[model samples]
Target: MNYWILSIEAIMNTFSIIESKSDIRFKMSLDSTSERGNILDEQSINAGDKILVFIDKPVGEIRYMLEVTGVDHTHLVLHKSYETGYGLTMRKMQQVDEETYNLLESNNHRQLHQISEASFNTLFSHMFEDFSNRYEVKTEQPVIHETKEDYVAPEKNPQDEHLPHNWIVFGAPGTGKSYQIDQQRKTYFGSNYERVTFHPNFSYGQFVGAYKPRPMKEDKSKITYDLVAGPLLRTVTKAMNHPERNYVLIIEEINRANTAAVFGDIFQLLDRNEDGKSEYNIVASEEVKEYIESQTDADLVNYEIHLPSNLYIWATMNTSDQGVFPLDSAFKRRFDFEFISINASEEKIGDIDITIKGIGTMKWNHFRRTLNDYLLQHVRNIKEDKLIGPFFIKKTDLEASDKHFQKVFQNKLLMYLAEDILKTDKTKLFKYPSFSQIVTAYIEDEENVFSDAFTEALAEQE
Candidate 1:
């Protein structure tokens, strides 16, 4: 709370205050996300300032407003809300009247535009702090059954080719690592990114390509080498076809399988050449070679396998998962590892809850605080790796349609917290109170428990 107060002060200093209201005239648009034409007078706003909008008529709703964070001749980008963080304002453009622009410049509007870089950073520091406190719960959105096709890099030059070939992302559960990859597949993979999971049984032949038995018209079945391209093969082939387009091959649960067994000799191609040509060798295991020789007439009989320089590999693994070990030194050298933690902003979580619950009557903040505190008291002694995921606070979980929230809390969540505390025998919790009862009782008692710590603890046990 103290930090939020300080951030507001820093934000105030980022742009010089517009003291003379009469000197400048500005145009405002509130319903930009929708087709509703809700515009307001420029005189109602101050340059480089923040405001909380209150809808007074038609339908009641509240919106946060930010001044034009940046401006160009065509569009003046405005900050949508504090939820977007202070530095990331929405980009939009409006036709500006020359007379109004001249009047604004002649007045103190010019002074407001002359904000220092240091002041801008100070404002962001505060914004980040506010964002952190509000969003403690983080969950990955469901993967849509859609794929994006296009490969232009928005923030990078067309000719730039310095992107890394191998990268690793580490994060707690529900941190959007998978969701981010799925949603932005086109941006990273040049419009044709492919993904596959790596498991203990996965091998080089299975990942690169494999053949299986196909039944014929007769009773007997004949095995034909089906050169069905795996995700890795598809990604490389796509990259070869479009040099200008980037291509990504995402390996989910990379640590689950032995990298050496799966990648085999192609691991050398992990390094990228400046000209964007991947160097690969025809080094396959004896079994793979024998299989290929047996199918001489197969389409994959004579194939050139080389990872293109434009091909990128993005791998994800949970460090806390069981049987997970550090990567081999050779494997480690090929990747840039990044750690993604759970850092959600409260304002963003609040908005998400509103969308999920499809109701405005519930106080989400209260629910979040209560749920988090319950976990804290019960799970204080657990390891950080075993901490409860914050995403269960979503409004959808509380709704009658899904018992996901209840199952997670009573089963998986309780198991994690049980490692820390036990009113009776901890093992009893795992089997006691059947799944249906657990959910029903939790839903009935979540909002009705007494304030007494003992009473609340007792209620949780049921």
Candidate 2:
């Protein structure tokens, strides 16, 4: 395993954010998908590497250390924060911990620097520590259901929360339905879930398996067609091969694609038996059977695909998008659904405020609630679905600065209102008749860019 030190500079508030939220983010010169001449792939840093976090300020020192659970472009998310970490002085580390000192000295002012694994192990005295990737085997432990109603599991992790066999979380845009799924799944299970987003062109062949052309191993000029597995098939194969464990399949934007066409005959397998196994089996074609055989070492069984009881499929549906396929009653019946209100994810927005130097400053939540209220009362034919959620803009963007907030507000919210929500009657929502006027008002007007009624509503609320 590789080790690295991530130096956090600039912005004092982010340290508390990272520590309180137990998630770290760093701006990198190169993205996760970027490639260079020196490293493997585009980024040398990967998911399994250990990271030593250093706070850059009056006294530069390494504080907490954590494992990189994921590498999302410029962000490095961990399973959880290192929790309680003692601050270590560079001088002490240099004398006592030479491995860490070497990396710190050679970092050369770079944000990220590789360190020796020996230095990492010397910092901690845990026995189960090794490079075996503990996150893999422990990710999302599935609770296997038995035919007996009272069948109890012998060994259960206390943190493991039982999940629904077939479930869907639906909500308006930015309502944190996906965030809810992600956070809850990580808490109940390990941080080892795979998610797939459906789009207009997403097809069954892409979701499941299909025969595709490939170059012959011995002859570059010759071609052959073989069955290739998709995300669902790969996940299902893994779950089926290891039935003792539970698995989860997360589908985002379930209605973006033609659900009926995408699921095809596999829809029959959505019905589950009492034990969570699929009530019916999908008849596997010869190529599918061959592919399954080649991919897995499962014991002898018929050439059929079935959903095991331990396999759970959870999906998210956005209720506020256009040009999206509708889920039929028959398809919808297979899963239980939960709806998230716009206010459900309000805490994420916090009490941060937006301020303009020459104009006025308003609490972020106050602005959101006031705007939503005004929209509901004043905007003709505008539904709650069209109203902005608590998380329409992230907390960071809200606190970025007056200019940045103004630009973001003008570019995103105002544009959304003019084009999408208030297109029926622009005068009902925005102060300006034209889009450019609306943007210009946000940039220059001191009274605010929203309709007079919205502005008055904000005043009354404040």
Candidate 3:
């Protein structure tokens, strides 16, 4: 049976009603009648598919599991309300398997929690207490036999679906580039990806493979060094063995380390052909060759290995990060860079009260928007990179008292301003003579006083 993924937006109104009433029926609008022409149509939704229901922001979680029982032009009905909450703008839906569902559930329903056909079948089989009603069982089988003559699976668009083998997501800090990669990892690799963060001291041995000391089994006092493969080598080996499935290796803050030094000879493998396979299949060093042979059962007589076409290497870079190791043109040419821009969505946090020490209770979203706007207009040389993302301050952070706000400002906002924004011209940026004075004014003054101070500073500059 074919599987699909579907999403639905659950607004507050619908979510509250469903939670209290236990109603499983909802309306799902189709683009046109032709869109629902046949069960086999590209846009046609069918019964027995699994659903991962998502609620609106502030309520951001998969609240329900639903099995589609029926679908019509105006509405879709579920056989059982596995979970609850439906309200708002749009919901993402997808077909998944029992394995995938279990994996998703284990991850706190955080990532890919879409329903699978296998899960639906299991849900359907045990739904009834007794099997005496044979006729009822026969009638309820969700086999889709109808097919339209014009129905065809849509052609894959390279720009939309296909990701380059080596790509870098570059953006201002907190622009959700890593979040995007995390979501894509769930979509493509499921739970089978390795993530590593690069730092100033990261080395080739730590990345590719390294010989580490371990105590000998025979003698407690004696120790032996063993070659252990790092994230890159392990992921590469896994990809080589399972060529049919895609494997991903995510390098977070790739520019934080010396790119050339961290990669060493493995850098050559970044050069790929049109088909995405490594162009120069280089032989391994004797140490690495022997290590590979010893570690795996697969024969490697030639001592040569190439990065498989299915192995995806993804990295993230912050535009404003300081002391980034530069990548040469040859290394840079191998990657496709996608820039993430600042999001201007006016999403606010709800159901929580956050009161700063000197400031009265205020909406977290309003405070963020106000601060960002003030910084942009008043602070000299401030850019989008210096602004904070909407999700930077989470719900949990607001649960605490003034301490949370203080910690956030000192660690995140003030640090950014000091290191990046006010480094060159502190006097031009703020009314205060020093960074400490500006921070003191921000903390000690009332909310309105602080805002007015910023405005007065801007006015003085004008």
Candidate 4:
């Protein structure tokens, strides 16, 4: 029997081993004829090869470390107990040494992950503290996956070519404005996209580039300041370098921040030519110019920076947020605005039951439609803008408990009504003395929150 030993330089090959969240035990059958078994056979996995164990989603994390002990081509089968836990039937088995198995089992699968050995040691030291308490783990091994294929980029949409370089997707709360951008991003840019949410405090320094402090590598006590490019700048630099590929910069809740202030002179770049390039390019600030010159190709640093046609700028805005900074007509005209309307139609997610504790078991779709209809008709000053979208309440949220429902209602819906929608309306539509009274009535099922006037209106529509 030929045993293959891995050299120190062969540690670069990383492999992900799949395991269920309920079970972290490492058990696999190595068959010489099978695809997975072939890799183990080719690599000559021995008792000490290091392998990463990944827990599949719902518990998405690299949860355990495993070492290969004995790799058998035939007659070695996985125990039925371990096979049932992982949802895999093993024809051959690779056993781990007793001590390695015991150490992993005792830890209950605490996550310890790092890209390299040095980083792993640093992290492991802080978490475990005892340097002497090291297990005799194995060397690098080949990944168990059947095949590794490079990703093929999706075809660009012809419609996207005609669309404006800058776009603002505005909608009511939960109207899937950001979701649309995310979908478009995956279609166009694949994984090459940067997303940033614009809060009130978001500034040009944070949006573009800023001189920030960095700890000195030689001495942890010493520090150095470097020009760290923000998401927009970093994406722009990446897009400029890779002109062949499309890049997306997603500005989530764009209206949340002071648009004029956050954008500063860069707002001029929003104006695009007929060909989708920036109509007027702007000179980068001294700090930004210096950073760009050092980081990117010479062509970018030679002249004023322009927003590339291939760089798609997508932004989202919620009309319900009162605190959002208003965009002037000039700024608004720079980008194409796509308005997303509230959709209250039911969505079916299999046969899953969504039962609220006090509200009883009900179809989520029916509940959203009926509630939205009631809000639009009977709630004072409540229009489609103030109405809830179908997706606002997820099936998982509904299944959790009434507490989740109450939290969403009190924090989002009721607060919006009390603070914005019905603030100035003298007519108390629900006939509740206070907002709390309205919430109480709805929670306790003491009163029909909607008036009898809406009953006829609802029947007329039906």
Order the numbered candidates by TM-score, best leading: 2, 4, 3, 1
Clashes of each: 11, 4, 21, 6
TM-score of each candidate structure, all chains considered together:
0.48, 0.63, 0.58, 0.59
For model 4 the local lDDT of residue 362 reads 56
Task: Please give the range of 10 consecutive residues that has the lowest summed lDDT in model 2.
Answer: 127-136
Global fold similarity of model 4 (TM-score):
0.59
**Model 3 per-residue lDDT at 258:** 73
Per-model CA lDDT versus the true structure: 0.44, 0.64, 0.58, 0.53
Scored by Cα lDDT, where does model 3 land? 0.58
Better of 1 and 2 by TM-score: 2
How far is 364's C-alpha from truth in model 4 (Å)?
Answer: 4.2
Q: Residue 307 CA error for candidate 4 (Å)?
A: 1.3
lDDT of 3 by residue, 59-84 (tens): 43344445667666567675434321
Name the candidate that leads on lDDT.
2
